[model samples]
Target: MEHQIDLTVEQDPSRSYRLLPEAPACGPRELTVTLRSSARDVVEIAMWSETGLLPQPRAASHHARLTIGADQIASLSARLISRWQRFVQFEPVSGSNRLREKKPYLHNANLTVRPQSELLAQVSELAREGAYLLGELLAGEERALVRFRGHLLNVLESEDLRIRFDSDLGVPWPMLAVGCERLLEGGRLTVDPFRLFLGHRHQVESTSGTYPDYWWVSDRHHAVGSANLDKDLKNVPLADDVLKLLNSRLKDLNVRHFSDKLLPDLAQPVLDEDVMYFFCHGSYEEHGGRTWHALRLSDELPIDAPLVDGYRKPHTDAAARRNSVALFHPLVVLNTCFAGAPATTGFTGLSAAFVRHGALGVLAPQIAMPQVFGAEFALRFLTCYLDEGLTAGHALLETVRWFATTYRNPLALTYGLVCGLDSRVVTSPQEGTTGS
Candidate 1:
């Protein structure tokens, strides 16, 4: 005999649950009803089991008090996710008992419901199951924090465990992944509402600046460049679509497109308090009485040639020797190689040069590879940092982790780049001045 179940909330008139053809009352079985509230209001959940059209309340006054932490509840809730492997403590609760006290269970038998994938899939299952069988779920008297595993995302205020239907770019999944990984690996499980609330504010607006605080010293032609493989390497060693995705992200970051022509006005005062991004062939040069970490515009022209003459050398030893500084130490994103590698003399290449000239931090790749993955990694990593409120290091780790998971390859080797520059580099430095 099929039974019907109905759930009513006393406090929330707006919210009611309907579960039809509920399971027949086969003795007393523990029912789990998942409730996620957008606000701190006490949510009352009622579950009733019926048989033969008779209204037999399997559990009456079956209530669970949900006291949402100030940080968890948001003005506008966004869905949160967690991975199965990260299963933590869940306090089992029922209408029969108030304060269902038990030692925290780090593992859940139901975690095997889905194979471990990204954090998004795991939480969605939990939330859906809760909503699917709302009728038979018994709410306990005391509020219980059912700790599960997942990441979180929201508009600009709060994170909720809800459905994610993406017609386009609404949620930043990579950012959320980074945040969750940081919490788990660092052994920090709590969320802070105030900081999260403020961080959400930046997402609502366009991140592009009216006048970019940074500049890219790149080829003049493909100034706003595209990734093109050389003829010798033409078998499409890797997917080109990945490169396209990377470029799309770069465009969002306001990275100007350019070809291999040098822009003459690089040495001019373009440094802002923001950052500088260099995406071109970069390495150290030990020739022409000029030994420095060089950033070569992909298509180099003669310095004295009339065709392109305005690009000034960014640094002159005389200026540093004289203790004279012209621009602010901008954060340098070096999408180039040997930038952070230490030389025999214990001197690094590009990072050393940037630091010497008063740049905050330099983000660069350690090894050389095909430009496709490199560009993708750089763009995604930067997007994570600037848009997702992640520190430089966290962003790098997350980007690599995503690659490792998605491609199931040793992305950590190719794109598992490091953020060589430290955050503290920019702190002591004053605004518009090189802190040396």
Candidate 2:
């Protein structure tokens, strides 16, 4: 169903507000307030006097003030914009936040939040009642400070103090301070962990930015025992017992489907009936102080060219095409560690890049972990995918089940390694071809 949320604010003249204009529509998730007089001096106002996550505006008027040296207002405004942008970035499922200022004493703001959960009930709710929870679940103050271009035209709220310090010359102190407080004290809204995960995945699907089968590129290498390797070099490492269980679930199955040249690189080329599987390695590289994901290729050339060519057989490149390595695509499965590390690199890892090119999906780890768990998880997951005719997500769910049952661990930590595509997406080159 369609998901839409609209919130408005107005100045309450009945009660004098320290903040220039009073906005009643300011709720837990978003706020829009107009300041009557521009805040030049440090003005105090209640931050959540109108509303917040607890279902009530803060009873105690929390102070928000701005007082700083020259150009502090501009800095504060920039900080506010930055914080709002960050909030919107995480709430990717929602449309871009539309922030409009109403001059002297008013500002309008809208935002959304989708927290990842590891519970099942939440998943069902998200699938059926996503819009319903928009109001209840997205209730938290995304705190940030806004120093105007000019000094305090006038104070808004009295109880909530808005303070400004010339010493706060660096980043906006109020914004960072509040954000830190929330991170340390205010945890995410309580929800079914499974449903939380489901909701997060659903929202991810709804985002405009592309998500690769594996957004993060892992640098960790996969070591295939001699017994597991097919002549084509594709590694199928499922043990006999696992294979039996898998075969029993999937009919009309053939092991050769994975062995044939499914993976092609720029050094290799593609051909008819070709199948491609990419196992990319990535890591955060720190040079001089800045760090980025380290990419490995058969050659030094940029990955975009081969990706542009796709599966069509190329004459000049055989090794690259036959081996089938794509820098970006849905078909590639990146099983690297922190392949999609956060903060520094964000989502530009191997997995994300591959998806942007042409990959239907990806499978990559999100955090650092032992090699054994990752390998076992990957093997079990692949076996399920090929043998049970399961979709990537379902297969992952099953894998998690297996882990929970086999290890008997009440808690298992693994980043959500999602396959970003519809289940109908074809892995085989010929699957998309018209009638024979």
Candidate 3:
């Protein structure tokens, strides 16, 4: 897919250009940004991907920067945003390649910049900016900054402008807001992330039996002894409330709830459902020199299916199996801590595993989040996804917006969409027809 944004100084007052893509780019895209200026005053251009995830710069490139001629033609590569990933920075290049000869400058200054110190400063600035934005958005409420770093894009610059993105994903808000704040604070021109997570309509196929449309699973009960007693002790009634909400709002949809007994069933594919909601404790464990994120079922058992037999094997020996069967394709909502944590090698976290195994998308937290916040966000997200018929990415973005507005907490950024950014649980009649 390709998108074009024409930015004229006169029409856009804030000089903030918003590029709302019609749909999410299924693959790489070419984004042409045309800046209309009467005089060639060096305009600093910054690009941000609102979906949060941005492609890393190539080895041959210094930073994610592109140079375009006065003709307003530039070839740039774009990637769709996945869950848990946030923020992207790109440098706009102009003129000849010889310009790379100049020393790197800090914030348009001629002074040579040290990489480490500059990164720290950028992180701090982003943190402060994020907190301030949340404060303003939430009416004087203060929030702590989620940690982030400033990645230097290796691009030769003929001008002193940059483009940064602030995504709705919880942790990177400060970084994105800081990038936006720079433009607003300095009165520089800016651009919104052009790549989007497009929405696709789904058809509910009828099966022979009354299969569930949504599955609510929780592990409120643990065995006699558990590794993390504190988590087990502090029981937040998330699944129950979420179940009530889903049942009440989505009366036409089949919703089912399960507890500890259903952990074994998870080993099998969830063929009959559209959504799987898991409210439990999750963590990363090292076995056979590989780290895996597992959700706790009982004190002695985790959702490491590769290690266990059909609920018959001893928990001690389950570690020997490395390749577990993947879950059936469902939009999985993992309301647990560290379920979305990135892996050191392959996709290791619970959310990543789900995606690897054919799950449409996984909504999980990058870090440990408060139970109350998690439940509330889940409620809002489901409402938007099922009732309002929004795509997973939009639903998450809406939920984060509400959280930021209501609590002024940057922690909302911690929750991420792992994949299936364009997925929706319910298909409206019109959307169904169009999709068909």
Candidate 4:
């Protein structure tokens, strides 16, 4: 019964999904959702697929199109952030304990009355609403997801979902929960909210910025480095454990710890390391009428967008035309708040800077997170990707699901990905090796 196809065949097949005349083709295993600015308070969503979104062999081959009020999505993103921050711990429990306190409290949130149930319902409603909007191409745009997922959208059973939001506003695609309160066509219900969250259910990534040069690393060992910018978190046992894992678990390991360097030191041609970790605080500043996101390590000055762009932007067009690009594009793990869900998808944040210049992918929390969870999340992700040999996308998706199921903590959903859905660690960094 669980695998039963919950088909909601379109009453009016005319409105069903269809492929566009010139819609480009992508891999059958992949789906791309693009959100672009349309007009005031409106955004256009386009879903492209090669094998069609439905499950049947003769499924509608048309691309999906929908226009949603930008404000609605913006509100949903804010609500998701507010929900987790209020119920779950965002900052470290204590400044001194930095990374010592480790516990998953998503189920009860340490609350005796168990308000999680209500919040779960709310999150699922948000998820349902999101699906309803995205599924606007279906015959019945107003139908619940449970009635359509089995035959319409190829989700839950698959995790390869790539999203590109070219608008100024960034949506938290992973945190949106779906169908927790809905009954399927067979009258079966999925009341478990943890499993319904998009981030936990799918390997979703939001990417923007110019494509990086397809440069390769000719080295044999994968270089792993981390920066502990905050003194409070610098000496934590978690950091030590991570460093040890990078050394022992990975073959031909190259582990390094970066110091609290200033802009000049960071500006040089010395951004080397395939896997970069940062244990620091994300800072935000308003400059030139735009929010310039920055990162602070220890007491050093903030590494903001402008500073990063000066050195991080991809090679000049002329250089790129000459086939000259960074020897290796790194996968950056920023355990900082607002790093993943940037204030703007434009070149206004450090994540954007790295993606624009060169990065396999950048993973970071969309909002402020508990220090304990941040440390643990980083460890789990790196362990899965570097040691377990999972792609960056799978590593992230599995980690979030693990946390939500094992610890009842859904904070992992707060972390978002920019590019690198298929990024994975390599044993030999051959110039031809391409997993990022």
In order of lDDT, best first, we have 4, 3, 1, 2
TM-score of 1: 0.33
lDDT: worst 10-residue window of model 2? 104-113
Arrange candidates by TM-score, descending. 4, 3, 2, 1
Task: Find the candidate with the highest TM-score and give its number.
Answer: 4
Backbone clash tally (model 3): 22
Ten contiguous residues with the weakest lDDT in model 1: 203-212
Whole-model lDDT per candidate: 0.33, 0.32, 0.40, 0.59
- How far in Å is the alpha carbon of 229 misplaced in model 3? 17
Per residue, candidate 3 scores C-alpha lDDT tens digits across 283-399 of: 666767776666664354666434323332332124225333222546778877677644222233455445544556777776555566666667778888877877676676666
Q: lDDT winner among the candidates?
A: 4
RMSD of each: 26.7, 22.9, 21.7, 14.9
Better of 2 and 4 by lDDT: 4
lDDT of 3 at 51: 30
State the displacement of the C-alpha of residue 340, model 2, in Å, after optimal TM-score superposition.
3.1
Cα lDDT of model 4 by residue, 417-436, tens digit: 88777676554444223222
lDDT by residue (tens digit), candidate 1, 1-436: 9988797767622111111233322222112122433344643323221222213334452334444331232211222212211222334455876546441223221222323342233333333322222211222233322211110112212322111111111111221221232222354334321122111212111010011122222111111223322222223323344344435433322333332322422354433333456555545556555443444443442221111112322443444555544343445565554343222122234443444444445565433333445555555665665445354545555565555455322222222122221221111112112212
TM-score of each prediction:
0.33, 0.37, 0.46, 0.71
The CA lDDT at 52 in model 2 is 39
